[model samples]
Target: MLDFAKGPILAIQEFFILAGQAVRNVFRRPHYGADIALQMDTIGFGSLPIVILTGFFSGAVMALQMSRALAQYGQVGRTGTVVSITLVRELGPVLTALMVAGRNASGMASEIGSMKVTEQIDAMRALGTDPIQKLVTPRMIATAVVLPLLTIIADFTGMFGGFIVAYYLLNLTPAQYWHTVWTALEWNDVSQGLLKPFVFSFAISLVGCYYGLQTTGGTQGVGRATTQAVVVASVLVFVLTFFITKIFVGNVVS
Candidate 1:
């Protein structure tokens, strides 16, 4: 007489156990440097162009919107600060997480899930190796380590994007713009934003890896896992982002 209402609770319990196992798997190996390096290159280096482009456009749009809104009250100089703050604090990490989730999370999941169904993961397990250790661990370590660094780059590029829009497109004075940034910017704001991405990375990577490890059937499983990995990871990222933002902002939102 199992209660259908309690089925989800069992699932959540299983998920946490897997999560603990995944964490142990990620750290149990002797050397993961190569995998880590590859992940950094893929998530950080390969993602630069898009991060820059999106960041730039976002900044430009923010500046435009803020400018138009502020112009009515003659607060044009404040527009630079507004855009800068928004980009550095909110847009940078959230957008970067979204990008990484889309670009790497799904791919990692599918690659692992595909390996799983193809008996490759099984072969590794049969050979006295932990599949979680061999596969999931590497991705988890890579994502956890690389996310903060990627966020730093994203933040810089995003600010530069705002600068581009502010100066070239909006014709705001460079001196004035820089001054606004200097005066309005705080280390807490920057650090708070950057900090969230590291956690976000873990959520995406772990969920992605978990789904991959659980994948079954065949090519269809891989496809479903890939799609589900992306959706689930992205959703988790946003959910975590909301909480992280609140904590960083010191419950200021509420």
Candidate 2:
């Protein structure tokens, strides 16, 4: 019980400290543009297909369920509005973040953990190179930049999926579905959609980096850190989602 209590507090404290260092390194000297670009491709383009698939299926299923429910009330026309609003305001960001967390977080932990096990990180320090700047900063930067773009892509793809359902399954016209989607979207909703992923990106990257940097006990430890990174990052996506939505949308407690 005491270990459980203190473990989370210590992890939280370390995570924040690592996050602060990453933020500070963002504008510091010796910016790794090449590494950052490579990381962006790895994190962004590499994750696109999964993001697309997740968005498409989520929106499609949402349309199916919502349309059926609304049909019982003779309100099927509201399907587009509901699907679009929910996807843009919540599902798109959350789902995309979760997918990225599952994929990238584990990868980050494993890669850095391998380096740790092999003493590569020590070599960097010995050679006057800062390992955090070379490794953690680029990954964090790339994640921060890419996640919001992926969320935006997921948002539109989900809307497209909803369009397919609204047009065919629900017997709604293309124009009607699109118009509802467009009109129902407020600036705040868009801001929230984009901002949530940005914040989530930070959490995911920092958690991965923190665990990666903490790796010990050889190959088994890498495996443990990889699993821990994914679990913690995924949970943070949900936990942060609630707090972020409350902050932007307001009145969760009230």
* TM-score for each candidate, following the candidate numbering: 0.91, 0.96
- In candidate 2, which residue pairs clash? none
lDDT of each: 0.79, 0.92
The 10-residue segment of model 2 with minimum total lDDT is 245-254
Model 2: per-residue Cα lDDT at residue 61: 88
Model 2 misplacement above 4 A? 1-4, 251-254
Candidate 1 RMSD computed on C-alpha atoms after optimal superposition onto the true structure: 2.2
lDDT (tens digit, per residue) of candidate 1 on 1-254: 56986877876676678779878765565656687788778777887787777777777778888888988988987876887788778887788888888888898889989998999988988888877766767778888777777777776676676777778867888888878876777887877777888789888888788778888999999999989889988898788878877786775555
Tally clashing residue pairs in candidate 2. Answer: 0
lDDT of 2 by residue, 69-185 (tens): 888989898888899899998999999999999999999999999999999999999999888889999999999999999999998899999888888877898888888889998
How many steric clashes does model 1 contain?
1
Off by over 4 Å in 1: 1-7, 26-29, 251-254
